[model samples]
Target: MRKLKIGYIPMFRGTARGDREILERISKELTDLSRTMDFDLKIGSEIVFGYDTAVKAVAEMNSFDPDFTFLGSYGATIGSAMIPMDKLKGLIGLWAVPEWELTGRLPLNAFCGSMINAGMLAKFHTEKHIPFKWFYGYTDDPLFIDRFKVTFQALKAIVALQESRIGLIGPVVDGFDYMLVRESSIYDLYGATVDRHHSVEEVIKRAKDQSEAAVKDELAAILAEGSKTCMVDDEAMNRFARLSLALSDLARDNGLNAISMSCWTNIEFNYGNAPCSAISRLNNKGIIAGCEADIDGAIGMIISRAMADADAATMCDLVSVDRADDSLNIWHCGPAAGCLANKCGVKWDHHFDMGHYEGDEWHGYGVVADLTFKPGDITLSRISTEAKELTAFGATMFDKESYQGCSGWIKDYRMGGKPMTLAELLSVIYNNRVDHHMSFAYGNFESSLIEFANWKGISVAKNTGYVDHMELGTLGK
Candidate 1:
């Protein structure tokens, strides 16, 4: 289940029962849903418009940094309210303008009466193409509310780990550390402290060995999936099982919530099954796991939030950067689950040829993953360290069926408001002031992101000349 943070607005427009009572009644529903739904709710106490409501609901959303927003009879001028929150997706306007006493039926006046508040939101965001959704007319409709609550709950559950601690097992591929603007970048942008352990061997050994029962169960799972049951000796399978279990346990033990390891030599030195499969399983379990100990996968972990699930992170790589389109491609290496696709019943695992790693002369294996960024909002971000820049670019979720592979692309992007050629895209990455590595978050979590940065007291956002708005908006003509 997804753990989404939600922002709620309380309404009492000309109600016989004061605003406090009105909010109290709504609070009951919010509380009940929090218990039953996956959504995490926070009441934005700011006024939501300008300044001066006794409650100040707008400031509340800003402070809470909610993933989904609940407009509780709030004023639309509160676009500033939108300014301080997180990714801010899935907007639900709640106008419970009290249709009491003389009412025998519809609360038309109660909801319909908030014309000014609603109009501004539509006008402001529509022009910006912010993609805000609306759900009005709440009554004793438990079923409908329940269903809506599920979706919003999922929305709230979407967490990109604003201050997350991703464990880096050993060093990255020689020069690739520059390609991964992880730890320090997190510290600078999100106050996230990455605790890098000095041992990759330990993690590898753990994954290379697991419990006897888990090994059997895993083998059975693969068997159930129709994988060629015996690719090697039974002993090796048991060893691989033990190692996998150990790796999981170690991550938990060290508080290394998410682990990325350099899986070549260490994996081959002990076991046979490519760490790829095991990593895939862990990712699906909500623990950010990436093969080859790559930081690019960290970007994938953040983007997974857009999937509306803890285990929805896609393991991918930075493929081609298309400057003309102002976009980038994140490619995967295995068969992904069906949930990420707009379709259903898709296979998320498959047999494949393993790359040359450790002492393995030549061995092949199976891997699984949902195609990268399919049917979900694509948020491609990079944290270049050379000059230290945290840049963000994105587009809508674009896909229908679940294709089984890692060879897909996001197309048509532009920089300087002009179509960019592939070469130009490369030049941008090379010449642009970035730390070499990047961070990715599905959809856009800039709101919560901002909070994280502020919380860290890192001046990345507040610093002038930080984001090259000129470059992003093509302002120079």
Candidate 2:
């Protein structure tokens, strides 16, 4: 889990009894509430009052080195006494308390000050091309709390990406041109980079060196976890488990946060089974993994996991469209996260292509876990590079029952607003040149994704034909 450091600066009109009283009350309330809430935001112990106090506070805030700085106001204050907004780095937020919270004549002029400070900060951030968010409401309003939650989570996701170190194995599979990524571009856009392990040979060699006892224990653990539904023979399942342990050892030894493997002919030709089950196990353990050496896909999963607070997420292809019901089939060979699998719906099985071979028939070739994704709201997201520039897009939709095989269904896919016809939807995907694989989590992360994209210097792709009704008011503006 990621912890967010927040530098909270509280401002008020000079020496006035009403302004001071309200600031004390709200500050105390916010401070007390902070201890009770489960969120990861850690705030400063004291508030700054003016230029002198703000100078000292800014130095202290620098020591803390917060990811976000909150400039809060209870009322309008003397000119030039406000905190030095220019000193802050990263995302800057202006929170204005509602003047209406007080019954009598305006003591705080909070709404007016908020508007003034917001405009000024907006101009400053715009000129600096810095990311920022704001909220205007009483301290107790649900709306205020919700906005804070979304913004903080979004910031957390961005910070996670900035700090990620990924282990990439092999290159893009032959002919999957859409999955290509440049390490320089990834570093520039998301602050993530690749540590390429050129061959799967090292992984295979390490797996073969495992002791018989260790391999037996791993296979036993797999079986105990309901591997019987997989239908794969013990010999093949054991080899797959050994490979899974090898990958986990490599990941831990190298201090990798995520991995992208090349599972086409290289690993299968040498090891006799695909790495899907291994990939699934890694994802279930909160380590992001991607197929065909897709660094971008792994990064997308990392972002989703961070925003969802380590919730399980998976990568699947936007395979086919269900035209009749305006739904799309999300399928992958067998790499779905075990944590997200429907109860009793996971089968340890073989790749679909292997099923067509002589006498093997779905129970041969490679070991995989077939799963029908649990029914719930799903966010489909991708990060793609074009001419060395990275861009992102996300859609919030719901998953339905499995349609066929272990495939999952995402119904009513809409972006911006309004449902899109299958043709229109395909057009947007083609126009944007997004990869076939996307990351899916069991909750709506559209807001966080949008904000994160904006912070990274790209506007999330939107439906120009629709109403543009995504609840991202003034985002990326």
Candidate 3:
């Protein structure tokens, strides 16, 4: 994958003298941060202290073309910084570096300038329809960095989607007519190009072509990685290994960032096995695969992965509701991501119930990684295109440690609104025509998603209904 590029523009008042020192200090800090941080950030070298200089710097940075531009006010007042901002097409964000405390007057006036710029840009962006974000804090604060990183990742995901090529192999499961996505709609809304491969036969053929030695080696690796194994006989392991390798090659050969595969009737019945294990393995390795040929689910998985810093995300059905505990059960027949598996480790298991279970032979070699998801806060997101318009919604869910074999409960749920009853939540989902499958990754990414929605000019009517206290389950009464 390509590294996320971020251009840094240090700003100061045009008439402000003796500001170069603070500017240099902040620049050097960013340089050091770029080397230390795990996420990729490409900081630009130029500094802006005037309208003319700002225009020149922006022009130069434009040539470099960053995913987002960071406009920082270091010891300078907020004046005409908006001049350069008008030219940028990507997301624009502001950094209000905290003022260094002293016995006398503030040295940088950084916070004051940042706040002013924020207010000014808020109006400017609103009137001009420009997308922007702002943060006020010390450079190294963990919370500040975390929030910024979330925004950064969101921008990265948006850019990735624009540059991505997604593959849809085979048709969606029958009767899931709603899940069939129009490629033109994806291109129009997200700029992602989709290619449809009409047959799962190609995947099976590729799996069969792998050398036996290679398949055995992959099987050994899988066994070693698992903390515990169950019912994973040689046949299942071998089959899964071949399928996994083949899928990896298919993705690489096609230059696909993600894939949506139809896994029901054709691949499972004719091939005598489900591709759940292969899907799980691909997700663990960062090649997102959505089951039942869910293109939007694959896109949502990629979005969650990027926003959560490449954390593994899975596409799962909202299979059951637990009103007693006020949670929803998220399950997908054995395709839960292996990386999200709890300490108990992933189990080699069979499909839930999809097979010929007659007297003599049960031909379904389910071949799946089974485990309860690890307990943590998670975000649920789904993207859809209906009526030629793109719509998406995101909310946070608290996953519990309590596991029942191959599923996890979203015992805690919060959307941007007043605290809601389980019924109210269900009503919201039902009323909005949400898809059955939702993509989930571990993190509280509600704010990030909202910001992304703003930048993309996508409607946020379904998501913008909550206050922060709702996240704490307080309802903000």
Candidate 4:
């Protein structure tokens, strides 16, 4: 992952009697933090006092081309704050430090300065629409650090999205119209490119070309990890290994950050094996992969991985909503990363739905990783078909038994900081027409995802109950 670049300009009123000692201490602490954290911090050489100084400071920071900038209020004049707020290009941070002592004319009116800055920016930037976040307390304060880290993580995720290059291998599966997305809209909104597209036949040819000697190590590794194998034969396992290697090479050669493939009936019919286990292996290797040629779903997985800074995220469907246990079943045809397997461990098996299709040769033709997801906190998110809205929620996956093929049961759902019942969640999904596929990872990234959505000017669907009225004009309001 790339480290975020952050620029900091400390401001103070020239005439105010401010404590230089405190300002120096804050600077040192921030410098130390930059060394330890995942961002590269560039602090201003001297504090800005007046409009001219503020302008020069802003120019210097702008030259840095930071993803985010911070206007640190040492005891700043309103003009100083406005200068950077107006000129800075991306998300801004208004940082205000509390006074060490209350007596004797207040050493530094930092809080008041920042409050005025916030109000001024809110009014002036409403039209310009510059986004900014508020930060209060000393540099070493725990709460301040927490908010700062979240902001940093959110900014990093945004960068990840903008720089991502996704490969669409084959079109959305037949009849899955909701999985379609406009490539132009995706580039316009997220700055991610989906220019690379390959037919299912092209990938199949690549897989067939792989020699037995080439896939020996990969097959060995896959078999070594599985506690047991069922239904799937040696031919199916070898095909999976070849497909995995082929996908890896394609991603590396094309400089692709993620991939979405039509890994269903098409691949199964053409190649005699589903790409589930291969997709799982790619995800475990940090190449984000989504099945059914769901470009938006792949993007959702990219967002989850970026926010969690984790290598793998699972793309699954909400198969069942059990009111009895207040839990929802999250399952897929087995493309989940091996790291998510429960204590029962990963096993090799045929796809659960393979029997539905015709042909005796197709029996045990689907190679999939069969395992239940380990118990942990999870974050579920999906990008709407139009790429204009995002739905995200957090839940806890229970330790109870789950069905095979990358499955789990999650309860205790929460969205927008409020507890949500399974019934309400189901209503939200159905009424909103959310995509059947949601990408998730084992962590609480709801807040980071919300921040990312806000930064991108994408509307986040509310967690409230279903609404019947259209209200055309007030769509995003």
Writing each residue's lDDT as its tens digit, candidate 4 over 263-338 gives 7778998888989999988988889999999999998898898888776897999898677888899999989999
What digit string (tens of lDDT, one per residue) describes model 3 on residues 1-477?
476667777777634444666667766777776777544555556667657777877887788777777888765544676666778646677887765665576567776776666776667556676656776665678645876776876776787788788888889889899988789888887788998964698998988899989998888877775632443466767778888998989999999878999997668776767788888888888888888888888888877787777557888877787767778877787776777887777877766566566677454466777788877777776666543223333333444554333578775456663344556566556545677888888877766776676676664434334343324221222
Would you list the rank order by lDDT, best first?
A: 4, 3, 2, 1
| C-alpha RMSD (angstroms) for model 4 | 2.8
Clashing pairs in 3: 416-465, 416-466, 417-465, 417-466
Please give the distance, in angstroms, between residue 190's alpha carbon in candidate 1 and its true position after superposition: 3.3
Choose the strongest candidate by TM-score.
Answer: 4
Top candidate (lDDT): 4
Taking all chains together, each candidate's TM-score versus the true structure is 0.53, 0.87, 0.81, 0.93
Q: Report the poorest 10 consecutive residues by lDDT, candidate 2.
A: 467-476
Off by over 4 Å in 1: 1-164, 180-193, 207-211, 229-240, 264-266, 269-273, 318-330, 335-405, 409-477
The predicted structure with the larger TM-score, 3 or 4, is 4
Per residue, candidate 2 scores C-alpha lDDT tens digits across 1-477 of 456666676766555446656656666766665666543343444455556766766677777777877777777754344436667656777777766445766667766766666665556445655446777665577667777777776887878887788888877788887778788888888777788854688888878888899898888776665554445677778788888888888889888888899987568877888788888877777778888888878888888888877557778888777667767788888776777777665667777664445564434565887778777766778876443323233443444666433467666565644565555566556555567788867666677777777677764665544333443322323
Better of 2 and 3 by TM-score: 2
Error of 4 at 114 (Å): 1.6
| Local distance difference test, candidate 1 | 0.49
| TM-score between model 3 and native | 0.81
lDDT of 4 at 405: 84
Q: lDDT per model, in order?
A: 0.49, 0.70, 0.72, 0.82
| Poorly placed runs, candidate 4 (over 4 Å) | 355-364, 385-387, 465-477
